[model samples]
Target: MKILHLETSSRNCSVSISEGKTLLSTCEEISESLNQSEKLHRFVEWALEGASLTLRDLDVISLGKGPGSYTGLRIGASAAKGFCFGLELPLVASESIATLAHPFLGKEYDVVIPLIDARRMEVYTAAYDGATGKVLEPTTNKILSENTFEKYQGKKILFVGDGAKKAQELLVQQDSTFLSEVYPSSRYLVDPAVERITLQQFEDVAYFEPFYLKDFHGVKKTK
Candidate 1:
């Protein structure tokens, strides 16, 4: 199952070449800003070149479908669909929060919550069972409050991703652990994407769109 995964849902713009769960190569850049339209193709080419493969050799094109940046998600979706259309390959789409949680699938924590910073106080999040990676709670946008996630108070809840930083003040008082360093990346897209590919759960390249949970709002330029 040779796959090319694109992740542009966050500041970390990444591309990964993988064969099933084994990652062959990855090209990533983490900065304060991301311009996927400008860098996506180059990163993909770099990853493919390093792996000594081309788009034609891939069995599927995977995309990190998101509840992250609107522009970033659009860019990634366009590229994924284009590659699938051109190469006549399948498309496997995985959520950004799920990809963020993939690396913690078998950890000791009872519950794992992956969050992507949406703005000042809100985050896009979903809860998953740590051992099995099963969704205990589906993804949604949440605004932090003092009692947020209090229902799981005594249990070991692991909070991860870029959004965790902003919620730290409140969550720190609860029975929660924070992993502020975890960010979205194509490398983490391998496991879930492989499962989708094996199940033949391919997306319609012609009509597929990323999960942009909210409407995009562009800032009005002021002089």
Candidate 2:
């Protein structure tokens, strides 16, 4: 199956095309100036063009439904919905945390935490059991603090996401493995998206929406 994946849940905007287990193409840009609205379609076009395929040729459209930037999520969802509607393809809504956790799947660790920046020292986070690859109940609202990971002390935790950098200093003393370098990308969504498509796990294109953990709060006006 040919899958086109879109990710715009963080600072980076990315798109990828994959056929079964083989990645055909991927494009990414990390500039804040080039976010979902500005670069998402371009990236998609580039990825498809590079792979010598068109949107109509895709079997499914998948996206990173987020707990990241509200604007970015909206843009991604809008684009995914548009493509799904236009091409009559199934829509797969993959969670941003799951995308962040994609790279570490199959690795053995006590716990895996995928965090996305929620601004003002808060993060949208969820815990996953590395051994079973299952998300734990009650996704968290993690506030950055000096001893944030104290509760998980003695357990080896691997942290990955955009918020990992900020959490690194606070979690320094804990028995933690920081994967601050990993960024959310469409490549991470492809395999899971493909699996979902194969299993017919899809969302209603007309009503599916990105999972924005909270309402958007832009910079306040200064009078």
Candidate 3:
């Protein structure tokens, strides 16, 4: 099946075109500012053109439902639903956090954690089985401390995502590795997405919403 994937869970705005397990085209840009409202559609067109296809050619519209930026998640979800509506295709959602762990699935680690910065020292995160990609610790928000994640200490662990650096600073561990600059992208959003499609797990486009782990709190005015 032909699929189009959209992921804008962080500063990175990404789009990809895939067909049954193979990635055909992917485009992404990580800007200091959140500009998904400006880049998403353009990247979608670019991806479709690069893949030599069109919106009507797509069978499913997949999105990395986020626990990241509120605005970014809104942009991505609106665009995904728009495409599904315009093309009359099925929509499926994948966890944006999982996209962060995809690259390290078969690496030298016993567990993989994807972290998204939340309020202050808190983060939205979960642990995935490093080898099988299974959800080990379910997603939730955690306030970072030196004793954080002590349960998974004996195993070699990889802490990756935009918030990994924070964990590295406090959650001290002997065998943990941190990669803080990493962000979710559509390039790695296709596999689990396709698996969802294969299982016929289409979302209710009318009511689907991005998983915002915490409520949005605007910044205070400096005056």
Candidate 4:
């Protein structure tokens, strides 16, 4: 089952090709400018070319449905839908936060909290069980503070993703580890996407939309 994955919910523009749980290739760029709109197509082509496959060779399209950047998620969804439509393939999607935590799950930490910088002092995040990769806290846009993860204090927690840097300073936990360099990547979507495909949990390509928990709010006009 050759799959093409697109994850563009954060600053990173990521694309990958996978065969079931095995990753074949990835093309990613972490730009502060959030230029995913400019790089998504090229990344997709790069991933496919690197994997020595073409659009027609893909069996499914998996995407990072988001609670991150609205524009970035839209860019990724458009590209995924275009590919799925063009190739007549099925679409599988995963939460952007979960995708960021996938690679770190079941590692050393007892809990994993994946965070996406939501500008200012707020972050889009969720807590996952490190051992079983289960959600401990549902996705939310949290305003950072020393008491952010108050309930999970004293546990060995691993905070990951772009917003982890913000969390490191504010989330007061002596046992916490922070990996701020991590970002949601298409490669991590492989296993969950494959499982969804196996269970026929595919999205309706024609009507699918990114999981934006909130509406976009652009800069207000100043007169």
Candidate 5:
């Protein structure tokens, strides 16, 4: 089974192709000059061309449906939906938080917290149990403060995401292990896609949407 994965939930934009369990190709660009809307197609084309395949050869298209940048998520979702519709392939929606936390899967952490910056002091956060791959808490909008996650003091917590750097500064408690360096990517999007494909779990492309934890607050035009 050939799968195409797209991740644009953060500042970095990545595209990857996988054939069954093997990763065929990956292209990543981290630049403010190129937005996902403009860069995604080019990256996908490059991956397909490099792999000596075409969009028609893909069996599934997986996307990192996000809690990160609203515009980025929309661009990714739109592209995924378009490809699914055009190629008549199944659409797989992988959670952005889950994708970021995918690296810690099967580990022995009591809790895994994946955060995405939501601007200001707010973030899109979720808690997962690494041992069981169970989400202890569903994704939600949270504001960082000194008292955040204070109740889980004794438990072993591993924190990761683009927002981890800021979260680390506020989470001064001695109990938590802050992984401020981990960032989301297409590499993390593959395993979840494989799992979903094996389970025959597919999304309805027509009605599918990105998971933006908060309402988008972009600049309004004054006409």
Candidate 6:
């Protein structure tokens, strides 16, 4: 199956082209000020060209549905939905946090956690079984505290994602480990998206929305 994956859940924006389990091409950029609507399509074209393919060649369009930036998630969802709608293609949605932690799948660990900054010491996170990528602890918004993750203290837990640094500081004095380099990428969506495709788990393109764990509150201006 030929798949095109899009990830714009955070400052790191990325896209990937994959055929079954093999990644054909991937591109990413980390820029806080980027206009996602403009750059996302550009990266999409770049990935397709690099893979020697075109939009019509894609079988499925996958997206990193987020608990990250509000604007980023909207941009990604809009683009993916547009493509699916326009091309009459199926759309698959993968959890943004799961995509961030997916690289650690099958690793030697009791659990894996992916964190996304929720601002002001809070984060959107979930725990997954490292070997099978099963959800060990369901998704939730957690407020950082010194005693966090106490339930998994005796087990080896690998923490990852853009929000891992903030979460790590709170768990550092405990038996937790952190992976600083991990960030959400479209390439990580290939396996899960493919699995969904095999199961015929396509989303309703018109009604799908990014998993925004919390309502977005715009900053107030004070002059």
C-alpha-based local distance difference test score of model 1: 0.88
Instruction: Write the residue-wise lDDT of candidate 6 on 1-223 in tens digits.
Output: 8999999988888999999989999989888684777799999999999999999999999999988889999999999999999999999999888887777889798789888888889988999988888898878899989777787878788888767888777774455678766678999899889899999999999999999988999989999
Candidate 5 lDDT tens digits, 150-175: 87677888888878889888885666
- Least lDDT summed over 10 consecutive residues: which range in candidate 2? 133-142
Per-model TM values vs. the true structure: 0.94, 0.89, 0.96, 0.95, 0.90, 0.93
Ranked candidates, highest TM-score first: 3, 4, 1, 6, 5, 2
What digit string (tens of lDDT, one per residue) describes model 2 on residues 1-223?
8899999888889999999768999999887563579788888899999999988889988898877878888889999988988889888987777778767867877788888878779988888887788876445677889777666678778889878888886665556788766668889887778778779899999989788767666788899
Clashes of 3: 0
Q: What is the lDDT of residue 16 in candidate 5?
A: 91
What are the clashing pairs of model 1? Answer: none
Q: Model 2: C-alpha RMSD to truth?
A: 2.1
Which tens-of-lDDT digit does each residue in 114-151 have in candidate 4? 88898899999999999998889999998999997889
All models: lDDT? 0.88, 0.82, 0.91, 0.89, 0.85, 0.88
Each model's backbone clash number: 0, 0, 0, 0, 0, 0
TM-score: model 3 vs. ground truth: 0.96
Find the 10 residues in a row with the least total lDDT in model 1: 167-176
Q: Where does candidate 5 clash, by residue pair?
A: none
Which 10 consecutive positions of candidate 3 have the poorest summed lDDT?
A: 165-174
Q: Alpha carbon lDDT of residue 203, candidate 6?
A: 96
Clashing pairs in 3: none
